[model samples]
Target: MSKLLEVKDLAIYFDTYQAEVQAVRGVSFELDEKETLAIVGESGSGKSVTAQSLMRLTPMPPGKFAGGSILFNGEDLTKKSESQMESIRGKDISMIFQDPMTSLNPTMTIGKQIAEGLIKHQNMSKKEAHNRGVELLKLVGIPNPEKRINQYPHEYSGGMRQRAMIAIALACNPKVLIADEPTTALDVTIQAQILDLMRDLQQKTGTAIILITHDLGVVANAASRVAVMYGGKIVETGNVDEIFYNPKHPYTWGLLSSMPKINNGEEELQAIPGSPPDLADPPKGCPFVARCPYAMKLCENHMPEYTNLSDTQKTACWLLDERAPEVEPPESAIVGGAKVHG
Candidate 1:
């Protein structure tokens, strides 16, 4: 697939009274046409911020674009005006935010909400848009969409509301979809349904997806590629199989180790020790240095460059250095496509 979006050395910072939050520090990634790329990490790892920066969606009074470019089909979106971005937003790169209740307007009917994008971007008439809105609702697996379209957001169940949000996002047939923790508030079953619905829709529409979430299970199920983030930067990126089967970075190993497993009955889940660093005064070296049990002197003093493991796999860790001590990720952590070893 061709590259649909490329974010290069993107940086975002928030100027607050007490400190400057380096929310996104030179983060970069790519999304290919009709592919799903999952950005997985703990909260505050800059996953949402990085995705939001793609649309210039972050509030700017305090938040500023520190550096870098968001290129969509070779066009630098950073240079586009808010007006220009508005034109691109729903039509080309729509987003499904984490919460639907807050994202949808309480005052408007779900049909009207979905219709708004169609009317604005597609230039459809009110009646036409309304009819299309019902179709969108149906497309996202909403039953009785025609009747439900006239109902308010409060009238819908949580899962239904999320479906409506997806309906609105897909209303404009966006080429790229950014789903920022779309399943965060749903129950397990509903999350599965939503994810399944998204995959089904993607198959039908050929929309490339940027799925930002902390759930590795979701990443395993939904993504073609994975980008692991830590302390406001991408620590590792690779195709799903390589990431799960041959993860290189210690941070990636820690993340994989921490996931809850089904077959390991009564086994306590492993959690990575220590918290992510405060970005305001982040470390001069590797941000994972403080928490890494495998930390070495070089890890504490200098950041490792991203080493190419394969054409599609890359990792940033001193452990990959030719002279570094030979170490292997715990066999238990290899749980994506490969067998889990004892």
Candidate 2:
């Protein structure tokens, strides 16, 4: 349960002809050994960008690290040179990108793609790497590993291709594995299988994981802790139970209310109103103030400080202030048909 990775006040910006877009603003979180931390948010909330920054995958010139430090294994990754990062990228921390179809090289054999890291980092011979590739394929539940290894990515099914990506990311037995939307675009059955596989792999390998996704179901199924991101910032974070059952932030309430409930017959999903803020000209006050139902005048001009609710749960909202009016969460925000009192 030792701390393996810590991102402190991390900020990432993208330059454009018009303005500098703050893709991530003072975002922070930590990962423990052999744990799964889910970063859940809608698209463009900076979940992927934050995950990419861990490996220095965000392209420079267009993307730049504006501030903060990424501490992994007691070293600062933001300060590492590209050459230095190269040594740590696949071997120490690895990533399973969103799309296996596009991430995997079309021309290379599946075995060779898996072997590339083994050959580069482990210094294994081509023959040895190929054997390990087969083992990895088999480990990920791909049938006929011996034959599948020699086939191209186009030859495999979508789920199999995703499994291959996981195999590649896990090949080096990395300390931290960042799976950015690993189950994206897959059917429910396949998504379940992938989630099970990831959990099994984490237990077997003792590798910490950072799962980035917009699906609350996926977060509930896989993660122990959750960080709810919105408008390029983490508005609330806590253990899974606290986030799902006792969420404090209005943004978190909106997310929960939107989740489909099987028992709530004929009930419509409560979608959060308004579009997310534009990062290029983000609100000077609370990023969510425009959409929050209980927004005060103070929320329009100043960001609220985070209020610690428990040892593990914290949220940023004017509603949590001692002087602010008390407001109950909308009935739709209830997790299991049980009301959550503020």
Candidate 3:
């Protein structure tokens, strides 16, 4: 697969009365054609902000990119003018948010919302756009799409609304789709259905996907590659198998141990104990140093550079600091795929 979107050293910071908040710091990644990339992290880890910055959506006054370039299809999105970005935002790169109700217009008919994008980007006639709208609705698994199209946002259930959002996002046949917590509000069954629909659509349309989600389970099934974030930086990144089987970052280990296992039951879910560091005045060494179970003197005083484990595996952790004290692997990480810290 070819590269469709590439982000280089992107940083989004906010100026506040209290202090500056570095929501996204020096993050970089690429989305290949027909491939799904999962950005997994706890809340406030800057995953969503990193997604928004690609569209230049961050508020200028408070949210500013200190440094970086958002390269989309060989063109620099950061260099584009506001008017130019407007044309690219939805047509070339679409997004589906967590909540569909907030995204959809209450007054407009659902059909009109989907058709509007078709008419604008594809330059379709009213009749053509309307027909396409119904087709899109059906494509996302909505039954009786033709009749449902005329209904307002309130008429549909939560899952249906989300499907509508997907239909609208896919109306223009974008090269890439950024879905930020797309399954958040729905129940397990609906979430599975929606995820299946997305996977099917991806296979059919070959749309590069950036799946911004916190769920490790979702990452396991949905992504080809995963980038795990903590305190605005991607501390661990690799192919899904490498991430799940050979996780190098202590943060990744913490996340894996925290995942609820059927046999182990609920109470055994081991969450990372400490809160994320304050981005305004984040730790100088490693952001996860406080929460890391194996933090050392070196981990607290100096930031560790990213260590290359393989072509598809990379992690930033002082635990990987060859000079640091050797430590044993966590007992909870005993599994077929999982490997001891290198």
Error of 3 at 204 (Å): 0.3
Which portions of model 3 miss their true places by more than 4 Å? 334-342
- Of 1 and 3, the candidate ahead on lDDT is 1
Best-to-worst TM-score order: 2, 1, 3
lDDT of 2 by residue, 1-342 (tens): 678999999999999999999999999999999989999999889999999999999999799999999999889999999999998988999999888778899999999999999999999999999999999999999999999999999999889999999999999999999999999878889999999999999989999999999999899889999999999999999999899888999999999999999798798778998999999999988999999999999999998889999988999999999999998988888889443221
- Residue-wise C-alpha lDDT for candidate 1, range 1-342, written one tens digit per residue: 678899999999999999999988888888889999999999999999998888889999699999999999999999999999999999999999998778889999998999889999999999999999988999998899879999999999999999999999999999999999999989999999999999999999999999999998888889999999999999999988888888999999998899997778588889998999999988889989999989999988798899999999999999999999999888668674444221
Write the residue-wise lDDT of candidate 3 on 25-109 in tens digits.
8898988898999999999999999988888877887888889899998999888989999899789999999887688899999
Q: Total backbone clashes of model 3?
A: 0
lDDT for residue 255 in candidate 3, whole number 0-100: 87
Clashes of each: 0, 0, 0
Most accurate candidate by lDDT:
2
CA lDDT, candidate 1, residue 272? 94
Q: What is the TM-score of each candidate against the true structure?
A: 0.97, 0.97, 0.96
Off by over 4 Å in 2: 337-342
Residue 237 local lDDT, model 2: 95
